[model samples]
Target: MAAALGVLRRSDEGQSLSGAVLLAAHDLLYEQVPFPLGESSLCRLAELLVGRGVVPKSSDYEGRWYLWWPKSGRGPCRDCGKSRSLTRFSGRFGDDYRYLCARCRATERHVIAERVEQLHAMPGVQAAHSAWVCGPGPTGTRSAGGTEAEIPSAQEWSEYATRLHEMLSPLEWAGFELPEEWDTDFDRRHGGLLFETLWRGDGGVGVSYHPHEGKVVLGPFDDVAGQWPHSYSLLEDSLEIPVPGSGRQAAAAVEVAAGQAGLLDATHVYVAESAPEEARQEFTTHRIRRIFQPAAEFRRLPLNELLRETTEDHWLSSYLDWVVGRAGQDVAPDIVPDAAALGVAAWCWRNNTAVEAHHLETDVLMARVNIAVTRLTRQYICPVEGIDWDSIKDALMDPGWALPDTTPIHSLFGEGWTEVAATVCAELDRWRRLDHERLGAQTTLILMTIGGSTGYTDSWWGQGRWHSICRHILDEAIAAGLTLPAPYDRNGPEAFLADLHTPDRLSDAALDWIIDLRGAAFEGPRGLRMNRITRPPRHCWDPFWHSSTGV
Candidate 1:
């Protein structure tokens, strides 16, 4: 009986056992094939197999009894056919061979399936998926960086002194010293601010408004090897100080950067004093706020958590809003939080969702392919494995579709899979295209390279009007030989090729304008896409993807 059940399990599509003497199971009993068992014996064996969970039972409505393996063990799912065994659950019928993968089982509920479909259909959802699958790459954000304000003239020295005085009280001026002759030269070391007073010796001091600390800082002249020894809290000066030479003091000095000053409180200052040999001084340190670093902020975006949600797009947008608000106002361009943090999160969420969608789509495509293969092979009495199903499946997943051995998969699986793979690939490509288009659409504050263009641009909006502005900005960034550091990178070249099928008159107009300006017409294919992008831009394009510079 177990032997018969094993044979039935290997059938894939399943086998039928009946009382009829001429049935296929009866032939095995006569030595016509293998497994010799009488007709009545086969029927009894089927009953025993069903009882032991070796084969799933068939409905009474069916003329013959159907036998299939138990669903509990690891193997391809009977429904979706996904070989990767994740959490499995039984179908409504029973806990037999008719089982589904977690996602497939979720579809048993019409509401859940509908919501999943709605989520897939949502604008920017597909884009997010593509971003996750590929990457958000190097989208820059507004961060706390050095300001490029015009160098203050000698006449402005008094005003600078007044601002500096606001940060320091007459009491803490004990060891603090100011230089007599203020250097008006723009120095990159002190946040591009001209020195109010220049210290002559090797241990010369400098001053700059700290963007992250929101206070004034006085540090060593050679910033690389030295420290900013002091940071002041202006709003409420219950004088917070750092122990003269502690690590925190050193950290405070380095964090002081040039940017628009923010409001500071008593908590912003830390002070400590080391006790001599006989006296052990208690180490008391005050922590006001974390010194902000864009790279550190990027690490904290919670991208993985966002990707786990069904509505990842909404969550990512909300998170970006929160980050922007937390960043606060009048932040110098250099010191603003990297605006690209939102895009990075969005990219991760989208990539994760896209992977899920890909697997789901693969199951559906493979099911159809399997059905066709089953019908054709059964008619021709051929081996199923002979059909190159793996090749077809791989092609469906590969974006490039450049299988090393391009020997037609159609020959092995028949022409049916060719259409199926093509259809699935086309659908997947749509999401990929959305992801590319959504890139520069997300944030305007940072310079980015939009679409398939080779140059970097400054335009924040995706509209045709803004594209021209972006093109000009790209030229400017290039002309200035600007290269960003760390979290920020120059908007380098991309594999973007504009979707020629875009329905927007503005997009078309913008293309036409480019052709006229450059005196070069784009005579390539219509509705053509290069690289990962697949379709035309949608009519209702959000210039900044869905992010606002509000925060």
Candidate 2:
């Protein structure tokens, strides 16, 4: 509990903990505390802490049981009427965040930029125009005076980011906005604001101000000098105030004030749609697509059809036939080989990973693979209890065996398991071509633990004598004249499998080659099932963590 609270308040302020977030923090720290049945179990637990004086309940929220949570937000914007996140309004605008919201600020900056663009090209005060204030302001700036001497503590700056939006946004947009995903830190750090009156002077002079850093820069906008370590300051005459007078004009107008604001290149706005999130999602989709080739026609291809059209590759043919026999009723176009076929495939997929010696800890790999498969396939096939022959057989015989709200795997046993187990073993046997002894040992273990039995898991994954599974798998592959690609184990199979149990020691580039060798991985199911996913889940694929758990 202490550790969880420490982590929650690590940003160094009384954190406004929501029921869900509070539970997550506590559960993460207390891994043994398996979540109770209700979604609000952890939330209700907060009442205990509050009642016992373990923590004080925040006045702002019933869920916020922190001793001293931060302020709500800048509040409803007097200008725009929307309570803006700090991304759009900063405390720098002063205690009340009086400055306009990001959009309103943009509208204002555009106003200034447009005015300058018009007057700089107009006759009379044909004086070149300048910007009054730009939204968010100059960003990604690397200038000097503004950053040379810092007045605030680094810890304090960190607090400012969280304090403003972490509190404000969550309190307002609770369900819609996630705390970690909020893009406020970059907004605060890369501040290069320009809030000077549009200069009516000629094009020779350019003005840039960084109020946050306490400095004003003056030079030609295109000066290659990289504004810094200034020898001159803002001159009284350099800054001339031009009033609203028709006659107040310069003798000659240079062209249009067409350049971007002195420092604002239009980057410092509050981009509600985060660039990192988009990029991460794109990369995930690409990685999944790399292995799971999209077959829009997959839904149309029935088990019977795919079963009928098989290659002499014997194993593919056997696997196809097994699918057809199990899910002949799944040919209804939308059902696509049916849910049982999916469940069987998932069970088989997990065993395939285990036989390949993917992870050091059997339970860890199995659970994660189960998660990945269920997510990828849209819960059509949930291999939640890990892999076993009985699970596969039930899925094969009963179309609705693993469908949503169906009987749990343990409770559903099948008489046809021996046949299914034998076929599964043979399919793995032909695909991997392991020796008789290696095949026999695994076949026995696989069958013995038919109906959700974990009896043999220790020998299968632990440091037992039989746990040379990684070594055995790799040894067989090498004997078959399958040497790794150049630059990996050029030293021979010994050096390659030397760190087999701890594959993470190998470099990432080496792991990519290893993954390619291990059938390029079927880490995810090809399609999503709406019954399975209602919200987004974070995915992180560690390139070198497994595929050895063979060594």
Candidate 3:
């Protein structure tokens, strides 16, 4: 009871104790109790604690009890109206809590970049072709006076040419030709151009390009709009215009620059009825013929589909089909082959890490044990007398029999509560160790048959931008009441807590742990039925994360 209250009292958001909050609270009490205590059971324990006055409840108005933390005097931020606990920068932003959340700050930066793009596209600022790198801003390098540093080497054209070439190289795959005049102008003008990227405490991004010796210096619209002028003529002057896609093709973008350079075949250009006025006008200016095609048809074909279709007799596809069949569903498109691929890839990646063979074997077992516990607690609840032990053995060996439920246990058996709990506990522990042994003996070579660890690990999970994403995923799952199994070994607690504070480590380790848990848990006769399963999304293939060489 005191343990539960200690957790609740530690919350920065002490308004409501959710399942995640309860789990996090329970984790915070690791020193007092080491075993895995389920969140529902802990909630029940909290009820007992509050009613007995062992842990005083601050309020019961929100359908659940809440305890206020003395230091949790935080509320909505004054600027962004977001609930934040810590103040990022204090007096500079009036009040510290008045500052923006990480996301809002990030958006502000993107907006700044966008505003800069709009400013550069104006007629007066002559960069020829300037684009705002969308999404989040990089950590800006600042001068001693706190202003952003200038783009050094105005006399060095080679450096600028290399950078321009690097950025433009990826577009070559779209089957377009670059104008000789455009390339020449880019090379000649590279040295005399100043590329300035500015950043604000609220994460606002502002980028500008001007002649190295030119008088015009553009910045954030609000900061320099009065002195600066907007030129509508430049909108039509730029060669390459990148249009962000929408709907099913949200992560893809179409570069309309080639048409302006006379590289687009008029017969190949088609504008849909849904194409915006701007796109239509641009298409018209380029003398491109229009055919109405659905936006869905314009989407880039998925790389996975292309690869899978091209590779004849791919062992990976065959394995996926087998796994899907085992899951009680026919191997079909709706099952998301990518999810299975990612799960297998993550497993292989973890195997390559320095973790010893013994530990790896133990982790696999613990994962199975976790599944058993969840099944016993949630799926197979029944009294000792009512549960068919022989049926359980048969079910474990075969996939047909249903696990026992709580109703049968209570209705059929009135006594032996302690004995029932003990019996199941022993059985789960035994299976947990055996499953570990079973998995340790299996080959990890199947992972190599897929895209291997390269696509799954290096792209998303390995990237710094995706560092906090695992925490986001976990938080989402916990909020949705998805319970994970407890650690099977004594050392399991530390492994679970490893990298909890570091986002990258947390993400990598969390993915490894979750996959291991799912692989073992779902390995039962009823395969992969859990709704709240974690997997990488198609957006993970966003071009923003990639350069010419790839992420």
Candidate 4:
């Protein structure tokens, strides 16, 4: 073919891009039995096709090549858009058959261009060399490198003092000019405020607030070395911290983040030492108040016994420090000899009853120790690995899909989980076999996921909208399943009319206990979650909920 095209010198008339030429070219490409052609021969064929007026030029054959390559053939390039695509069709019947296209074959890496400028009249003296990461490459992957590439990428600094602030407002907190002494190892060595989070740095590795290549970019890699690492997001994949409000709200934000991350303990607890005493006490008590009683102001609750059980490195140690010694200290109370201590004793011992009947001789330290243990174990234990807890929970739900662990505390005393497992297996067998039960569970999952809720909500709810949150609580009796629609309130807004009956009887406390089972899966009760998000956006109904009514 090259010989034939070579015999005919470049013809000014070439070939008119006519129907006959297109018909001939199409037939040559698609109609004939597939056959082999050498690279040299292929170029000649392109020239021949050009001479026959199929394509008018060869200077940029690619511009038109893409328009025609979809000739349904025996072998086609699978990865066309990728850099290392295999669009090569050798055309041989059996030996070489993969095909690659012009665009992918033309892909190239960015070249770092360099231009040297000699200094003084002095021999061999050098001023500097300008360098930049020249583009026409894949994307904004590599940093604009080289010492002389002075075009600062508006990404090297943040205005906020902490990583927490930078994340909330990345736009306002964007890049600032460097101090210009950045040539040494200093940038990577310190990793302090300039580019890193003030206090969020964990063992010198902090996250880059900027998203890069759809990955969680990590590093302070020596800019000179120019190598950085990226991982999927958790803290980098397994956990994601929400863009909670700036500064002081970090603790509250992390409280939600930790549970969502399925973590054993809160990973990032940001309460500045300079925070107020009231704030510190509030932070400490907020945790205790979630599961324990006396949600308001209290001097302290005991921690010494729990402290003895724990070591210095325990995850709770630093948090416990704030309220540790404060417990056991005496405060005055009327009519009782040591009523101040009694109040502390009350939080540790009170489980369900409204009454406080511990003896005057009640061991407050032991009682407080028990409370501390329950706080950590029952309420905040990490999500257990390999447990299809949802399945177990489904088995426990009554037909109404009530919350589990609703039994009086005493009822949970003697039975082991083995019996529960048997019941769960039986229940799951029953639920899965029933089409409505299975589909209802799936449909309930869909409603909860009005937006992405999967990661934060258990696969269950991450990938869900940031606003949509689901928390799973586990109770002993009430196996929280799909939320039946809230019972119609005769006195509700819908029932608003002139002649109203007395207000609906359920008090706020009663409503709390009643709704507590709505999303119970395996452990402690996480309180009501709505716009306020009190208990870390709590509860995902059993995957199988017969939602006859609205939630």
Candidate 5:
């Protein structure tokens, strides 16, 4: 048996078969040497071994490997029951060990193609053209999916040109034409003029012309009336007439007056032939008023003209007051509780006192009392609604003053004012803990909310003006010869407190820190009223510092 085993290992065919079987079953244990193999070579080896009666084979088992043949032809094919011919089948690899037929591979490819087709059918995928996908051509190339590119055809370009002309036709109808003397090719060369639509409330469309580089712009009007005199004119038949009169006049006359007041050196003028001198004078007066006074001031002028007349609801009156004056006594009464709470919060912030929950409640009450006095002083200003007074007072008394409520006053205080104050205070506290390097970034965010930043352009809180005030305060503080504290990596609250009292360099870094403190003080619940009247004795700290000193 040993000599036969050695002979089987030495034969070329026997050696090749043994090597292939061993490679296939390398992981199998020697005790499990009779395990099945499915490859063709393994079947040939099985035939060789069986011819020598090394393993049993049934008469029904033909070219099957000995490992795959059951002793009684009873067990399922030792390779797998699915294998019909042991010589024809081989095991396939998968996520888990499984026997796969050739048929399953073909099905996977079909499913992938169907999904790709569905994705291409989505909306806008075909409608939106990208130049990258459609390479440049005289007429842009179409996409692989057969969608036309955005490249415009000659006919389409002509139609777009026609539409542009149609849009501008009304301006031509109104005696305003694109400067005809210039080249027809000017638009092509200069990328065309930017056309802006001017809408009239009276259901008219007007066109305004701005030249490529010219300063003078012209707009045509049906009537010049009370609008800017220097900028508008009414065309007459072949002659230019200046509108006549003063004080109260026709629209054309007012235009002339406005033009004259503006001292415009008119190279051209359009005038109405039938305008009365009174109309002309009024036009000029309105123009003068507009030219000399600011928009807010001009709007508030107590003129009884139709155009200058105030609204019935006193909207303009309230708006002007809100813009130009401090919060009126009546306005304060409406939001007194919120304003008071904010004041108390500001007080606590400036003094470095903990803004505990109880303090917020007590300060709110105090704010209400103060607001009530202001409201009473302005009692004659407007009729006091009984509910308005009671609601405000009750809201102030309530511990949950900052909580959301359905009433308008509650909405304003609980939602608006409280939110702004809370955000400001929180931001201030956040920066107080940051190191000096992050001070500027935090200060910019805080000032942005308070209108202290450059974005405060609307004149809404007098923010631009306040920014100037803040700059001046910083300048004074820096000029006082203060020294900066040594830089630390991670300074905490105690370090912040120490820096506040210590003298510091008045660089952008120092200014940002001081501005934050001042901004917090300004936004604090109590309003600071500086007495500009009294002159402080020598050795006085800056009034701003003293006023903001919390006490």
Candidate 6:
């Protein structure tokens, strides 16, 4: 009964009785009965099947692993297609395993090293340390190659002078000429005035009065490399700072001013360090009072009013308001409002709608709409305006516009309208009229010469407007005496049919005539003649035959 069962279960390929019984047991235990078989037992069954040729052995190093027929031999090695080989390897014991050939590995390493060297030699990174230490001075002080100077404080210098029994050392100062273009009024009103006094060790620092805090705060001086990095540290440590007004009164005034400026949600206001301690304390207290207020109740504006205020040259606030308004319009519908979605939509509309070259997907959609509008206006609507839509249609349908069958020109443009399509079409038409005169020029020769693989697939060509325009131009050229031989044809015919067409089997004489005519057109007019080739004139249009056959 066991032998009969094995025979009944045996595969069509003639496997042994034991192997057939094992496979049946495997299928019954794992799949039929739904009893879970452990990995070790599964592997053992796989080995038995592989030994019986019911499955394939993938590798000898590992125990017999089953290979299904469909998935086997599908992968090809990068180096050679003959045998399956490792394409990637993990590192073992700190040494990297390589699956690539020795030559390819060496080439890859050389490329990586060159890129690394280029990065290390970049100028910005090389000057980082020197630029950091020098601050905003005209020149950096030279020190020993590997050593740096210690930064000194103002009190330390004064104390040292007093211990030496010397009068205070004369203040050594460096003067920088401010450009006339610098706004003096903005400087005075904001805090640019405080930065004018160049303290001995102080690099670049600016000051601004905080109206809300009624205090003067130290800000940073703007240089080519931007604000001084150490200004924050100085602000925290400075003593005997100037105080201007009351912080509570200033904060109230700022709130009123912000409301007028449409900044009702303003949260944090900065106070100047030079402001009076009383005013600073009051401003801090007022901020604490508003700590539990809902964020939606107020708008947050940066505390530096002088910087935030709009001038004719600076319209940041107005622009921000416009952006916010647009965002509000887009998010009025969805159940769950997403700020990021609104921002992305706004960005796409602004960037894609206004600029020509900036036309991305949104711009393409807009252009398609524009083209449809233009066509509709010309056809159904332009007649009311006394424009001739019929004439335009007739021009498009003219015999002069008909293209060749062999030239697959329509496959170049994408499906939708491209912004550059009209311009490209006009250029192609101009070239078609000029022909030899235009294409003889170096620039035109470069444009017309088709040498390298375009790498564009048929699907890509089928979808674009530019592809269709290209097809139209090529077809038009063929109709207007520009004969391009079919790309697939080896032995040229006067009219080469596509491969899918049934051959008509022309008479010997007619076939000879076609071949001769095509050969002459290619070799004589195009200057692609081969030596020791002779042909009789088959047609008047055949330039080579005209010279050779003299018919």
User: Could you estimate the TM-score for every candidate?
Assistant: 0.17, 0.18, 0.21, 0.21, 0.19, 0.14
RMSD of each: 30.4, 26.8, 28.3, 28.2, 36.0, 38.3
136-219 per-residue lDDT for model 4 (tens digits)? 112322222422223223222221222222222221111111121122111321122223421111111234332111122223
lDDT of 2 by residue, 284-365 (tens): 3442232122121233354334324334446444433443223221111111111222333344544533323333233333
Clashing pairs in 3: 109-204, 109-205, 240-257
Give the runs in model 5 whose Cα sits over 4 Å from its true position: 1-127, 130-194, 197-551
10 residues in a row with least lDDT, candidate 5: 533-542
Tens digits of per-residue lDDT, candidate 5, 288-403, equal: 34322332332444334412442342533342244212222111011112122222223223222322322333333323323332232222111101012223333443444442
Residue-level lDDT of model 3, residues 369-388, one tens digit each, is 22332233222211111122
Off by over 4 Å in 6: 1-15, 18-22, 28-504, 509-519, 522-551
Q: Write the per-residue lDDT of candidate 6 for residues 480-531, one digit (tens) a residue.
A: 4544444324443223332211111333233222222343443332210121
Instruction: Give Cα-based local distance difference scores for all models.
Output: 0.28, 0.31, 0.29, 0.26, 0.28, 0.27
Which candidate do you rate higher for TM-score, 4 or 5? 4
Task: For model 1, state the Cα shift of residue 6 in Å.
Answer: 79
The 10-residue segment with the lowest total lDDT in model 1: 258-267
Cα error, candidate 3, residue 499 (Å): 7.0
The best candidate by lDDT is 2
Ranked by TM-score, the better of candidates 4 and 6 is: 4
User: Which model, 1 or 5, shows the larger lDDT?
Assistant: 1
For candidate 6, the TM-score is 0.14
